[model samples]
Target: MQNEAQYKELKEWRSQHIQAYLTDNKKLNQFHDELMRKVFNKAFQTIKKQSGEPPCAFLWFVVGSAGRREQGVASDQDHGLVYETKSKKYETYFKSLGEELSFGLNEVGYPYCEGNVMSSNKVWRKSLEEWEEQLLEWMDSQSWESMRYLQIFYDARSIVGEEKYITTLKNKVHDFKKGHPTLLRRFLDNMMHVKKAVGPFGQIFVEDNGAHKDSIHIKNAAFMPYVNSVRLLSIKEGIHATSTLGRLSELCLLPGYKELKPYYENFERLLSYRVSLFKASTTYDEVHYLNIKKLSKDEKKEVKHILKNGRKLHEYVQKIIKKGC
Candidate 1:
């Protein structure tokens, strides 16, 4: 009954304000944070009714876009749990809490992660000790999937519980990368293939067929290159910023990374274009596809510029990392 009531209130609120929030990425993300935090608290209350109390301290941190505080209206779940210790009792406690949190978030309109990156998955629900070991294992593995997991984990931000837990673990990743310079190459390889968004003729690429036919994949084509390149640099410098813009801001301060400053405006423009162009939608996947058909001539020209720059940014970062190596 409590869950149902809260879900209805949240859904109603979202329906009312989503259009306004769509125009402002920062405010939209803050709204997402508020909604998720409320769900977290409600999940806690629900869990307490079943179990007495949490056996120990635990943190619920978001990853992916939510972790970076950059969510479109149709965002899905990407979160994990970090408990204080490695005990079966504590594990059981958090496991239930994790399930409840996922269920609650889904009820309020956030879809479940397709990759099962949510806390309900045991792999993402871990003790502090386990997380450290897991991070080490991921760094050491060097497999494509492991590297992808490491990248996702790097974006984690604690919305509830001790923020230091994530910081401590992230610092460990930084220390590992510093000790093993070759690891940077692996990071580079993991994201080196920037999807081509513009043709040799300078025309913007769009989907060839299906429902989103003729629409550009803004997230992959425009967003990923910038995101992946900046992330690699951040990893190299041990900068802990999760968002691309935030990472660029920190990178701008360093002497070697000064080249990244100009691209900051490019990224800001990209973010604004995304929010202003895409309206609130029902599906998480649809937000990534921007229909060029609806865009004005000036808007299309701006998108082309952004896409071309994104490709250049990918190449520039690649050169920088390779030169250092």
Candidate 2:
């Protein structure tokens, strides 16, 4: 099928059925996964019409929330491309595919990443060897930008082509960390501070002004503590899973990380709370904003409890990583 036809089909499906999945996080993400894979495959076919056949095997993968299988009702694109080898001919062919995929996803409703992390960027479209080199460069760099890039890439999951490409790249990161144990501290410093949600007075903070005035930024203030802390622990332990919950599960099995079990429950509740509260969101920003006035007293109390536990989880991971390093 042509790209426009695929886009129309996807848009129709989303408009008619997305509302049903919004209240359930797992189902919603599964919906995104299916839609994205269809786009990926169709984009390839469209590109093939122009470029003939692929010059080499390649992988197109998603990072960020999509990569972790934790997408909201509204999400933007965060993806990259990795082909088997280097050459100007291969580069030209895959670059066209990358641009097609990005445009295709956007036309079908996914927004372009503001950070420009999409596969359409030259930095994110690389040969396998180039990707390895870029990973090493990011790993060795002290700059915050490079570290942020590294962390973003850590969450990548292939949506099309060979999965082993991503697996190999992730293992490279793990091996690098293992050889340079102190790199964990750098990661710790980069990720340790989460936005303060609850105040010393035990009141939750809300935006003082703007479109989301009086609303809490739940994604930053609550979700990141659990997500980033668990991610750090996963890196330190050489756990290769990308999802926060998946990392927590792997952690709970280890002798050193049995204490993480409660935090697992807390994170689970956080996911449920987010999806339940944000089901009405029609924009990406709205998905992260929770207006305090709309929440029931019991719901507010539950949010406070989750925020408190998130802080505790953050501190626990910090202490453990510091002690081990």
Q: Write the per-residue lDDT of candidate 2 for residues 206-298, one digit (tens) a residue.
A: 999999888988889888888888888887878888889999999999997888888988888888887887777878887888898888999
How well does candidate 1 match the true structure in TM-score terms?
0.96
RMSD in angstroms between candidate 2 and the native structure over all alpha carbons: 1.6
The whole-model lDDT of each prediction reads 0.88, 0.88
Candidate 2 whole-model C-alpha lDDT, 0 to 1: 0.88
Error of 1 at 202 (Å): 0.6
Q: For residue 97, what is the lDDT in candidate 2?
A: 89
Locate the minimum summed-lDDT window of 10 residues in model 2.
1-10
Q: What is the lDDT of residue 109 in candidate 2?
A: 86
**Native-to-model Cα distance after best TM-score fit, residue 270 in candidate 2, in Å:** 1.3
How does residue 9 of candidate 1 score in lDDT?
75
Candidate 1: residue 186 Cα off by (Å): 0.5
Per-residue lDDT over 1-325 for candidate 1, one digit per residue giving the tens place of the 0 to 100 score: 2367756676787678777778788998988998889888888988899897888888999999898877887889999999998999889889889998888888888899999999999999999999999999999995999999998998999999989999999999989988898888888899988888899998888988999999988889988888888888899999998999999999999997787776898888888887776674578888889999999999889888888988898989888889878
Clashes found in each candidate (C-alpha, N, C closer than 3 A):
0, 0
